[model samples]
Target: MAEPRVSGDVKAAFALLITLAALTSLLGVGALGWVVAPICIVLGIYCVLRAPLRSTMLTLMFFALTLENPSEMPAAGQWQSPFYMVGALLLTHFKTVIGGPWFFGGMDLMLAAAGVHWFVKLRGRSRGIPTPKPMIKLAHLCYATIAFTFVIGKLNGGGDSSMAVWQIDRVMYLPAVFLLCQAAFTQPKDYMSVGKVILVAATIRALISMYVRAIVPATVDPISGESDLPYTTTHHDSMLFGAAVVLIVALIIQRTGPKALRLAVLLLPILFGGMVANDRRMVWVQIILVFAALYLITEPNAFKRKLQRFALFMVPVGVAYVAVGWNQKGGAFKPVQIIRSAVDSDSDESTAWRDLENFNLIYTIRTKPLVGIGYGHGFWEVWPLPQVDYILERFIPHNSILGIWCYGGYVGFTGLTLLWVAGVYFGVRAYHHCKEPYDKAAALVSFGTILIYYVQCFGDLGLGTFTGVFLIAPSLAIACKLAVKSGAWPSALRPRQTA
Candidate 1:
């Protein structure tokens, strides 16, 4: 028999194992510092080289584990494994290292090297099919907008330069966007598989956040300004509150199974913990939107059936909320105050509204309707009033859209509107083609979450955080995947859809 060839990927895996093992022995894991630090470094690298979907799944699991127990890994070395120790310190401060600069930077390095290697391997062969035209166009538009902002800033000379850097970082949205482009050219089923990875990662992140927010104890630093943790407290409140919204939408859309209830039960502590954190405003707002949207999305018959089922489901939750109303210092769902706080024109809750000394966003819109300021600039700078200065007090704008307007001016504002409209249009089309119930449900979860984020942006910088990045990236990837699967992207280009 002829000798069989070992695949390139298998060879790569073998090489990775050998490298890790050698590093372990050389570093000497007999000491506590040596044991886990190298292990984590190897795992982090492993996550980058694996399939994007698989790597994300592992990343989520790691995040959950770390959040649940900050001290789960052995302490990093005082000297030897400095990279690992530095990563640990960063993780401790930010509460997420997997999605932070280290992970991305490492991946970028590996990808650049691998891409060159692959190019050499295919030196005489044709290049892999280029990404789809439409997807490429969208990516180009995004990239162009980012470049345009920087150029405009330079041309103007001494405009908010920091805002230019922030807009450039917005290019981080590109990786996930390119992933969607890949999805457009690949099999549709792989999209769901990829989506499942994202959801699982989110679930893992949520579970870990539950522990952090509910059970973990942490301290706030007065001087350097950071969370000091003997790991005493976690930022559970938002995680739980957000989880609740994710849960209800998941159930309604039927994405998660019985696990939804189980997760909800597990998440109770997080919900309570979030309330204690005093970040109740967004949580309460999210909850109301979840229920309201749920009510709107269902048909008459299903709505009636769901109403009965919901009542049953609400029994325990309602009772708990009622009983623990004040006692659950860690809970959300303050009906009256939530609405009042969110809409209160004079309070910090209404940052832009109060800052501008205006009661309505509509009024502010009338003042600078076309371009607005730019991404971080908002109306406050152009006007430069005492109240605006007092409210933000040397801070960025709370409203994401307003910030775009302030920084980018009319041109950037137009680009933003188009970007969001494109997102919604394609996202809805993706929702329509989803065949599986769970897939549909997950799509709905994304839909509702995006809606909440978009609405929240009017009052807060909702889409500005890494949380927003996680939410939008997966949603867009899933959308592109769905479109490709439905034969909407072109049969020759589309791969078969799978669950």
Candidate 2:
């Protein structure tokens, strides 16, 4: 969708940022960034205090689009990201004492501010503010799971207590952010703004992806290099790539004009460039699944009928193409190659590793089916695999669904299952009950995003990462908010009736 008008506040924020960036260039960034850093922090603090919700969203966007997760820390051939500095500000504990602080640093403060404002506004009986009861219940479920798992782990002597805490925190990050987003929003339409911002952010991220692709060698080894080489970016980016595609498609439909065309023309190439350049096969699979999901959720129409007709003819051709390209090495078979590399362990070492890891996780669950090995312990290895540099290999598994089942046993698995099931239920209800097209379209976007995120967590280690939480939390919040607005969800608390 074409973005709304550029407001004065947005202009001001950009101008202020541009001025700060200018200082970095004029005084030599490397040597003098120290001087500018504190100034920026002070300014940031002021901005957050003045406008917590907007600032919170922007920070999330930065996390989603700018920073890389620890899994893929120094992206090859690209300039270094200011990861540790920014990550510390977001993730480190900010203490006023020598000992550990009571607070959770900047992120906690931001949420606290936003939560307080939400309470004040709701107390005054503000119209259009959503009360997501389902989301609130789901948050409790998530926290309870963590608490239960942590205690079980400690009692069982699973492993490092601190590491156990960190492991559970990462998993709980989604529900925590989901609550914050639910509180921060005042109206259903607010979701559209979040969607637009993420789309734009993904586009910018795609540009960076293109740059990384250009400078690096496409493959590390001559034979099997395509599969042997690491993914073009982080594993989580497969989610982002799929997100950009579905969001653009869902937003642009049912609209016409130069604006629509221009939006598609301008953003699609950059977004797709990042997607293609990134060279992760899962993105392609996720994209197809998301589109199918969106189609199934939406009401049937002429466009869909046409698509069915198109598919009837193309299905055989697609089958034939796959038959021929399954073993071919030509560029025409690139999509087929990606599919093969993803599923066949022989073609890609990464896939083989995940398969072995899956067996290990399954064994871990079978051994401790009730309380689980808890969060602190590593997955029990029936088929031990070589250790990688990743420190949380034991804690975080590629198949997060199975990982949860193993870590938390039946109880934690129930929590995760209910959370996502509730999210999907709300998304579908919102889409069907929407009174307006914008509402419907937004519901679709949120639904598709949540689905893509689930695919990531199922296939990759997305459940325990910042990127996945940032991507999924906002979308889940939006879905519930829309469902409530559309009356598909009953009011959590009835408003005061005025005479």
Candidate 3:
């Protein structure tokens, strides 16, 4: 067959995009001058010429941005600050895609790209822009509502300005990533490629955590307290690492690649060891829940066999943990010590504090009920005034669901619950609709990962950070797209061009 001709309209639009990029670069030259201008021009040209490479480049950038640690790389911060890492990575990627020095950052550019793509695709179609599926629409609505409520609360002097901005990003910008990803992941192969990127990123993180714990133990030490082995950053980064572990195992169970499987098995000790060293009870629970969910979702009939296989897998892992713990000053690896910490409800300071926080949340909810004191207001009510600064700075919430209830009231709480319900529904539908075993397995794995994070959100802010949103949103988008493509849902909601 002859190569399909590029459309005239597409060529024209691309030309316009390039011109705008050039203008932006020219404007920046006045401010940034000679050195930055030439590099931007070259990168912009490369991006236009290598348009197909955009996805892979963005994936790699995502990995680098996630792995960046400002505390550890203060020197690098002078050149590129951690706060702007995501923005910088995104701007560079967008500069290539749009063919100029686009200043928009993070998910904004992606969302705008998706919108433009949709509009272009709709140009000659009878149907207008197709409404997204109900669940997807509801998710967008929830994020928008929460964002609006947060801003209003902030205007009312309910929370600190910086924290309000962070919360707005978490609620709105992060979930918007799903729409951007949906625009790119149009084919099964594309979805698989994204999965591979995630696996590679996770594996790198696992390896780095192992190396850090060994070489710079103090660097990995628990921010909450000292530990023998360096622990992964708690709440945020640790949960992210745990999510990666879950994804890796899910992909392996799906049998993504025999070679990759062998490598992953080799790295399992390091991955699991990092999880153990992280010393977060919630992460440990997340790991267990993910495995159990994966088994039940993917192989419901072979429970006994799966249990045997898992037990065999644990043997080497347990042995490695013991071996590592043997040399440490404290028996951080000792089963007894770990178990004591997990179960010590009355004595463990963290546990006691969480219990108190939970009580305070409950009390506040009962008092305010419908529209609880806005987003950050609960912190002041729940904790002492002196500790409010520390608590607000960390954005720590013992129970995320309750925290939402405290922040946006029942309306926000219900919206979030429905979103998860919709996620689980679509995830199951994806599995049912997929004809290929691998696709089915991928669907299950993605769903299971989201489920793990959803469950974690009940007790921790696992689903409230950029890392958590990035991991879950793309997977959710993949599953939903599969569901639409496989005819599990009506095609009415899928963009006509996408269908």
Candidate 4:
């Protein structure tokens, strides 16, 4: 042996331990526990030896544990997040059956190890380059705004606990977004990697949605607990719609670009699979708007050329649609009932009520006007009974503006609104000015996709969830990059001149 090559030794050790653990576990308890314990010990050792693999393994373990027993995973719905709540409290308060007490001690150790690794990497790479001062300032500003709102809510009283809750929810998103922004700023290639990751994640999510729609009966099981599981008319549709929009832009860019068509081609089936899952509004709108943005932003001559080619391609698609007309009843292309119900929405009472609720929320935001009622405070609570009727269960105000009103109040709201205005200004300018066609296409598609979220938020609180926050951050970072590339902002903080 070559004096125990580090990589080879680690790989061999990992494989051997994993194999022994699996085999021993299959035989059952006593030996199984012993075998697995050694493997975990080895894993801890190798994790330090192989940082990337360790991080990946840790993430995988987290997801696996969550999916296997979602109910048990740290959550406010029942038991709190394992580390922060139970571990920090109960485990610390009393001795345990296994090991030295302290509930969250192991978690703290893992987190500390991860933090050390992260700082080491950061220090190693930040050789002579200046720290990202402007980005850091913006990050601090966002953090301050959140802290200020929280402090204010605390000072105000317990009467507005709901508002405080909403504000607290938004604070969770900053870290994830900041991490993504850091990745984009330091390694733009990472953004593209994230794009591919989204495609992979979306594919799995689409498949899950398809299974849920086609296999799982809609019947509610009383024994399983709860009266009814919430049904989403456009549940599986978001990923499909977003992917389709991306695909269309990808196809259009391919017309004149020196770029790979593989991503778009690869993603098409995933989009179709999503479409088959039956939710449509968000997806369909995303597709339309992305192309529309592309058309709007490109130079007139280039756009005309692209449009002509698109029209030529669509002729064949149109001809096929006409030829097949309603003949494929049970085929993959069959009409979806969800689509029909969605389109024929004028008379639906549920649709009317949902829309009305959304409208009322918007109107209430107008009442508080500036600063609104304080971050996460009023709007939704006042929503079901705007006239102070019995408080219905507080909900996520479907609209983003309403959410801002409920959570951020005036000061936080002002900061966010300025960000939006700046985002739009830069986004349009970036699309028009970027030198690389693929980069331009990516920017425009991202801008349009994000814009769709703006529209979708008019009747949904899509941004409140952590998943939604992750989705939004990348789009914002891309927009920011595009803005910088386009020179929409002056080299200084001053506004750009209009010719």
Off by over 4 Å in 4: 1-135, 151-157, 160-163, 183-185, 218-244, 254-266, 278-280, 302-346, 380-395, 417-429, 479-499
Mind sharing the TM-score for model 4? 0.63
**Model 3 TM-score (2 dp):** 0.70
**TM agreement with the true structure for every prediction:** 0.61, 0.85, 0.70, 0.63
Off by over 4 Å in 2: 1-42, 52-55, 68-71, 81-127, 217-219, 222-232, 254-258, 496-499
Residue 465 local lDDT, model 3: 54
Over 1-499, each residue of candidate 3 has an lDDT whose tens digit, in order, gives 1212345554554465445444544454333433443444444333323343225234533643254433223221222222333333333334533346654442344445445654455333433122236756776777766765676566656666656655554466445566555544555545566666665666655665555555552523457564444344334455566666766666566566786577667766776775654555666666777777666666554655877789899999887775675434444555644444455556356666666677777777786566656655544345532254343533446577777776667776776566666667777787878777677766776677677677577666655555566677677766777676566776745444563
- Output the better candidate (3/4) by lDDT: 3
lDDT for each of the candidates?
A: 0.46, 0.70, 0.56, 0.47
C-alpha lDDT (0 to 100) for residue 56 of candidate 4: 31
Model 1, 202-258: lDDT tens digits are 444444434444544555678744454422222222333453446444664464577
> Model 1 off-target regions past 4 Å?
1-135, 158-163, 171-244, 255-278, 297-300, 304-333, 346-395, 487-499
Worst 10 residues of 4 by lDDT: 67-76
Candidate 1 versus the native: TM-score?
Answer: 0.61
Query: Candidate 1, overall lDDT?
Result: 0.46
Q: Of 2 and 4, which scores higher on lDDT? A: 2
Clashes of each: 32, 0, 1, 12
